[model samples]
Target chain A: MDSANERTAEEVAWIHRIGQGDKAALQLLYQRYASRIFRFVIRMIKDEAKAEELVNDVMMEIWKSAASFEGRSSPSTWILGIARFRTLNAVRGKKLDTVELSQAPEAVDEGEDASTGKSQEQLRALMRQSIARLSDEHREVVELTFFHDCSYKEIAEILQCPENTVKTRMYHAKAKLKPWLKNMGLAEAELGGVT
Target chain B: MTEQRMDELLAWYANGTLDEAERQEVEAWLENNPDAQLQLAEYEFMQQSVAELGDDEPVFNTEAGLDNLMTRIETEEAANEAVGQQSTSTMLERLQNWLDETLNWNRTPAFARVAMVSQFGLVLALGVVLLLPSETNEGYEVLSGTTPAVIAAGPTATIGFNVDTRLVELQQLLREQQVVIVGGPSAIGTYQIELPKDDLVEARLAALKAHPAVIYLQRNEP
Candidate 1:
């Protein structure tokens, strides 16, 4: 078997052991997925402490539900899906103020300067800000696609949304990102010599 | 395709996930649309920049979090044991209950129910693949003398192999582990192959490293 299949099988095996009450298997799982989950949750909640707590909550949910993992999606997809729901719930439960995505400025005058001539780090900072300004749904889709390298189908599974919804979110996300990238002049800089 | 459909295809195009035919179509579309091509480049640049955002940067300490999880799992396990369940049937019973509650198959929209059932079928098919006997009872053959023998139990790594290695050859080498190509050589020359994850990950890595055809091995992170 190739590595991806092997990893999936290993995850299934871990879930099986977890079903049998194997703490070691659960630990292996924690080692495998915690960081990724942390990054994802941190993006969603934007609170280090809360994200940390939610990560544990997610692992706990997995610990309790590992037995029911049907291998329909990859273990990572399942875990992240669980984390997404938990993070959204935590956000709602806390009544946190999410940015009104519609209010995001179309032009970033200051970011444009950084994009055209600034270092890659500066451009990345701009990108991060652009991501932060996205609506929750758009941002999640963008993060899954760009940072996690998930396919549309995987993102759908993670978000429990339809693939077309994923595509639409991504399209709107890019639309939101476009003006920011344009303002930064980052896109122009990157593609300056392309055509 | 409409403008909106083309826009969606552009995202896939920049990601290098588009198949050859789709890619060709996108490329053809781009020929007359330099603006779209620029957008594609911008998307590619954006993706790469985003990927670099969290490069080995420590997010937060999870050791304590893991400890808490272990504690809860132990607590739950002990409580269940105190109930004195001997047969594995109880585990299966609990799993069934959880599945019913989680999927809520009865109330889920028709589309979700279909996805759930399809996923179940795929898993069952995989289980059958794993159970089938191969040249080695453990399910994989060591392609070279230097390759260490490993007993397949659970867990798998998705290794990217050289482009020249044929799929049929991989099937012969992989044996009981299903050799599914999940991803590709893209701009870089690598074929992402999925195999059953098992204890013999190290052995498998060593075997692949020793094999002349394996290009790169990466463990898929969820």
Candidate 2:
């Protein structure tokens, strides 16, 4: 959390520069938040190709109107909110069949093993697939909590849900995964006690 | 202890949403209950499992991320641009309405438009780019031709010189309407010249605007 605070402060400097009409600062801001925005959008839309295109639009828009930002919220929060709004609109208009999770390639490789021939990639890929199977709301809670490393409060704020609601969604997500884990031939002991 | 109660507390515990007192109460109960112990493990399992998922960057795929950004920018940009156009049109309509209701816009179009736009105070300037003399094939042609000396010359009057330096001087003495020529050089390193009497008055002013340092127009006889 301290580190995230520091990152936010640095990003605010970039935001300030953007407010002053600095094009370079605007690009830096785009690059800084592009992945975060992409993840949120992709997770919602579940369509990699479309998500990538939307991310570029988000960046171009940032460049075009950096001056419009009034610092009503921290730049990160504001960008994330914009991403959220965009994803919501996109998902609303999109057909359910458009977000086919099986079609998109893995987002990250994570690679096969750190020391030996053991492949973390396979494990990570499995994890991603499992998470993708959750309901949109469930997956979103997991995404906010695990991937973004957001605290429950932050997730609540981002999702505009009550704190308890976020907890409930997270509880549900974990419960949905139990059967899958049991099939993996791993219990608490095998998966490093799952902690 | 009931599994339902344990499940409830475990959810709060996993979220770290429990207060200190409730947390202590859970901790005290978990110290003895085996079922509570398993539930505690379940809660811990959920938290760690999600944490270990380590999406550090969920939208790490460059191609997808850029695509997402582009789509968003389009919507926002279109919306903002619409708002901008609407506001500008609104202001224009309001001003026109006010003018029609309050003031004498029955004035001439030229005067009314000028006053209206002038309030915006946006000045636009344009400057012509000049080429260096060495870069021009026409440098020699202008070197040889003659020009009138000044505006009073009725746009055509004799102004001539023979050498580069003499031409330079002559240019200094002519107006935009004035024309000058070079008949060639004399033995004394000066130019043979002619200057029409009619343009004598405005020759100097025209020469300044014509870049006198690089051209010359002969002065009219004083």
Candidate 3:
């Protein structure tokens, strides 16, 4: 089997061990996904402390319910689905405001001067800012596809939406992001020129 | 595939997540359209940027988080064990009650009952001789002199009376409520009282429950 499949198999084994009340297996699973889940949650809720707490909460849920996992989806997809659910709930329950692209603060990378031409790092900084500012739905689509490396189907599973909805969200997310790239002097021709 | 369709899939294509057919279609479209290439590049750049968004953020304290999670799991396991023990105790109590009601020794033939008790007493005496210390030679004592006879009357209810209730007061209450003591004040002090079938059983039970002398009550339907 390929590395991805092998990793998935290993994770499934850990989940089985966890179901049998193996604390070491739980620790291994935690080591694998805790940081990723924390990053996803922090991005969604913009609260590091609460994000840390929610990461443990997700792991705790896995420990409690691992025996019920039916292997319907990849373990990563299941983990992200749980993380997304908890993050969204925390957002709604706490009434936390999601940062919109239009209202996002201007990119302020060090040594970034408009007079000088933009470097790759400068452009990357601007891209990060723009992505951070996308609407929650759009940003989630972008992150799941790009950062999380989830296919449209897996994204749909994580978001609990139809595959077509995932596609549409990605389309709108790119549309929203293109303008920001253009504003950073990355027009259609220059997009290819970025080395 | 149409350009609009290709546009919708560009993000997945950039992330290398499209299936073979979808990937081929997107690549074929990209070869024919240079604009699509730029869009794909933009998507690739976006993917790289989003993936690296965490590079600047401080690392999360995973060890501490794991410790906390383990603590919670331990607490949860302890609570579940306590609940399991409690449930077992309750189930055993229910099973004992079921056995008491279903296998009423009082209904057995007197000869068989006496034989079973004699066998039981012999086993107990042997156990006491084998298990007890020599210095601790206190013999078994009978708690009751005789077993109460079984009541074979019509519908009855079992009740427990308050320990401090006077005999006069209990007799007066029974007379007023029109219930007769059929049996018991068994080991647990519960008495079997026969209620009039003409009166509503629930109303009678509710009235009994409200009386100060009565501490517990239950229907004893056969």
Candidate 4:
């Protein structure tokens, strides 16, 4: 099997053991992916406490429903999908949609760069501000693709959207980020192609 | 593919998500299009900036969280097991309690309850007995008075018959039936009958009424 299939088989074995009520197996599984899931959830939820709560919820869900794991996707993708839904629920619980939050005039994060020679850290901070400006959906696509190194297909599965939709959203997200980067004094030559 | 599709493909190509065939296709499209190259360059910049956005680990106590979660799971499973382990008698008691609660039976006085049960049982038993087949018909008797019936004898017999065979047949028929006089002739000169109180009594009285010795016969009670 390829690496992806191999990883899925390994996680499936762990899940089978988890189905047999193996707490140690659950712990092992948690140790393997907890940090990554926390990162993913915290990015989406934007609240540390809620994201942490969601992490626990997602893991507990995995433990209870491990027997139902059909291995249709990789274990990481499956867990990330659960995290996605749980985070969305938490967001809804707070009476907020990412779209609304992004649209809010007060929620804008325009990292106005100083008009002088700036350090790489300042440039990076400005870039982070640019990301903070993108809509929730576009931001998620960017996060899953660039940070998590997920392919268009994996991102589509995680976000429950079509592959073309993922690409389109990325296209729009880049459109939003391009001006922000340009304002940071990064020329087109140094920045390379649109991500 | 349209220029918009080329841009989308370029986006995927920069992210390394496009297959080699699509990557070559985008590369071929980009060869003659510097503007697309510039757009692709901006896309790459954005991709790099987003990738470098640092993710900070949230401050959460994993041990405590897991402990709470495991405790909850254990409690739920234990409760389920306890329900499963309940004895059949306990379930029966619960059912009985529910019935009593629903019907308000527990509020009834003890003696009245017993009396009600006894009456129900008696009615049920009587109904069954009535339904059963017996020598007598069901609902066969309804007395109008408490008085006994009267049978009067004639002065003497006057019949033309083969005397020997007639007497023999009469004796055999009378022997098959059982009859008993309950009282003697009083001032009215009538005998009272108490036995064979059934439908057959009417037939027996008819035979006696046809006899020349029977002056008069009447069934005053049944």
Candidate 5:
């Protein structure tokens, strides 16, 4: 089997053992997923403490509901779905969406001139700022696609949206990032002829 | 595929998650449209950049998280076990009392008393065996009124109020039904309420269910 399928198989097995009240299995699952879940949640909510709390909550939920998992989706997908649900709830409860982008710290240093010779790190920082500026829906599509390594279908599953919507969001996200890429000295032709 | 469609698939292509057919289609398109190669290269760079975004962020302390979760699981299990033990103890006591009242072993002859005692021993042993905690019985208790105390007290129901339901309005409604909130606002925002008396449980439940604020309600099954 491919690596993804093998990972899924291993996760499923751990979940089964967890269902049997095996703490070791739960620990193994936690070790595998806690960081990933935290990263996704921290990106979503932008709160480190809440993200850590949610990671624990998600793991605890998996422990409680392991037996109920029928394997309809890959374990990673299911776990991410749980994380997304919890993070959304927390976001709604706190009205975190009201937080303005202007309040967000800039990713790029103002002292560094983009036109002058820039280091790779500076370019990456600018890229991060461009990405961080995208709307939540668009940024999520980008994050799930590139960072999480999820396919369109898996992204759809995590976001509970249509696959076409995922694709469209990614398209919009890239379109929004194009100007920033151009400003960062990338050639226009290199940006896929995107308007 | 159209250029827009191919553009949409480029991210997945760079991520190497496209199916073989889709991969081939993208490859063929790229072969014909050589300019698309730069776009594909840009996508690969975007992926690398996004992946590295977390590199500067604080690392999640997995061991600490696991420790916290384990502690929570242990506490929850302990609470559930206590409830189960209490239930079992109450059941055993009730069984013993019923046997005493029915058999009246103290008033019987010596031989008859001995036989009755032996039978009571067997019955108690069976009760203990049956009531031992099982896999299905252990863990979080979803229903609040399933406990022995709640079961003996009165009827209860789980209700989910509308998010927009006003506090005063909810109070008036619960006051009319003579029920008090017992547990929850669970993960799904459902609450467990205990009714005043079991006499008009069905009518009280119907009234509660009919309330405009009562979006969801389930009668607690003991």
Candidate 6:
């Protein structure tokens, strides 16, 4: 099987254990993806405290729901599913449709992740601006597929669409985004049609 | 593959959705068409740009969140525990109160509550825990003559209710439903005559005649 699928199996086992109230299982799962989960949620929620709370809620759900987990799908997929559910719930309460990812939930690496800081605020703004241009469906799919590294099959499962349709949507999504990215400083050299 | 096929295939290629044969075809197309390689890279980056809108991973401190959450969780859990605790307390209070009431004497002290519930200790405590009921609507159902506790119906029944209501919502509650009107009063609502000969339903139908109304119900109780 694919490596991600294998990893998912491992996670499923850990979750199964966590459901048994094993904090170690939870800790292991936490160590595996807390940063990424936090990152994903922070993008969705745009609040440090709320994002963190959702991250906790997501993991807690994993622990709470582990025993009943039938391994019908990947564990990461399941966890991210929870994250998505929690994020949507949080944002619904916020009365917002789409969340901007530029707002990092909490302090980023002060040095390495400077885009999360002040100097790159304009870049972040441009990024968010470019992204905000897409429809909510497109944005949601892009978030799940690329940023979350979810497979098209996984996305189809998550979004309740045929796999081919996901590809088509992603195709249209990328096509729509190209001109925007190109306008934001990526010249012909970047496109390489001329260069 | 033809250029048009190549274009269609490119959609599947970017997401790696193409099967083995199609992927091979894409590989050949890329090797011969350097232009397609450039297109793929650009597509990938653009995909990232779109992904960035959702890539905002504000640092989520699970520890910190759980810390705060646990406080409230603990509070609610405590309130629940206290609530759960109060039932036995109430039971004991009631028991003591019943004793006081029967004897027509006085109310028992708070400590009497703890003492009386100790006999059913573990069972009541566990019952209090596992059965800490979710908050039910406090609205008085005048039909029931008391505040009706929301009982969780069958899991299947809940699913059916949700689906039916959703259908009703989508179609103004009358789409797939075939209502057979038996007879109802001029007021109220038209009653759906379900049972061919249900006396209770017929009586309900008769009683509803005082007002302009519509009564719709299924009387089949099997």
Judging by DockQ against the true structure, name the best candidate.
3
DockQ for candidate 3, please give it: 0.47
CAPRI level of candidate 2:
incorrect
lDDT agreement of model 2 with the native: 0.57
Kindly list the per-residue Cα lDDT of model 5 for residues B84-131, writing each as its tens digit.
999989998887788679876447699987887799899999999999
Instruction: List runs of model 1 lying over 4 Å from the truth.
Output: A1-6, A96-107, A110-112, A187-195, B16-24, B27-33, B54-58, B78-222
| DockQ of every candidate | 0.24, 0.11, 0.47, 0.22, 0.31, 0.16
Model 2 lDDT per residue over A46-143, tens place: 56777766677566656666677776556665676667766776767765343455653443333332213435454445556667777778888777
What is the docking quality class of candidate 1? acceptable
Model 3 chain B: weakest 10-residue lDDT segment is: B136-145
Q: Which candidate is the best by lDDT?
A: 5
Residue pairs with clashing backbones, model 3: none
Model 5: residue A122 alpha-carbon error in angstroms: 1.9
In candidate 3, what are the lDDT values of residues B144-201, reduced to their tens digit?
3244234444557778899999999989888877888766666666777888776576
lDDT of 5 by residue, A1-195 (tens): 998889989999999999888999999999998988988888777678888999998998899899998999889889999999988988898776522467555654433445368776777766877787778898888888888889999999999999999999988888877766656656644455442
lDDT of 6 by residue, A67-138 (tens): 998878677667777787778887878775455434323322222423333433444445555555566567
**Which residue pairs overlap in candidate 5's backbone?**
none
Proportion of true inter-chain contacts also present in candidate 5: 0.64
Worst 10 residues of 4 chain A by lDDT: A101-110
TM-score of each: 0.58, 0.47, 0.64, 0.59, 0.66, 0.56
Write the residue-wise lDDT of candidate 4 on A40-88 in tens digits. Answer: 7766655677677778889989998998888887777788899888888
DockQ of candidate 1 compared with the true complex: 0.24
Q: What's model 1's TM-score?
A: 0.58
Q: Answer with 1 or 3, whichever has the higher DockQ.
A: 3
Better of 5 and 6 by TM-score: 5
Candidates in descending DockQ order: 3, 5, 1, 4, 6, 2
True-vs-predicted CA distance for residue A160, candidate 4, Å: 2.9
Task: Specify the poorest-scoring 10-residue window by lDDT in model 5 chain A.
Answer: A107-116
Task: Evaluate residue A151 in candidate 1 and report its C-alpha lDDT on the 0 to 100 scale.
Answer: 73
lDDT of 2 by residue, B104-186 (tens): 56564877768766754543211222322233221122223442222232222223333354644545554443444433342
Score residue B84 of candidate 1 by CA lDDT.
78
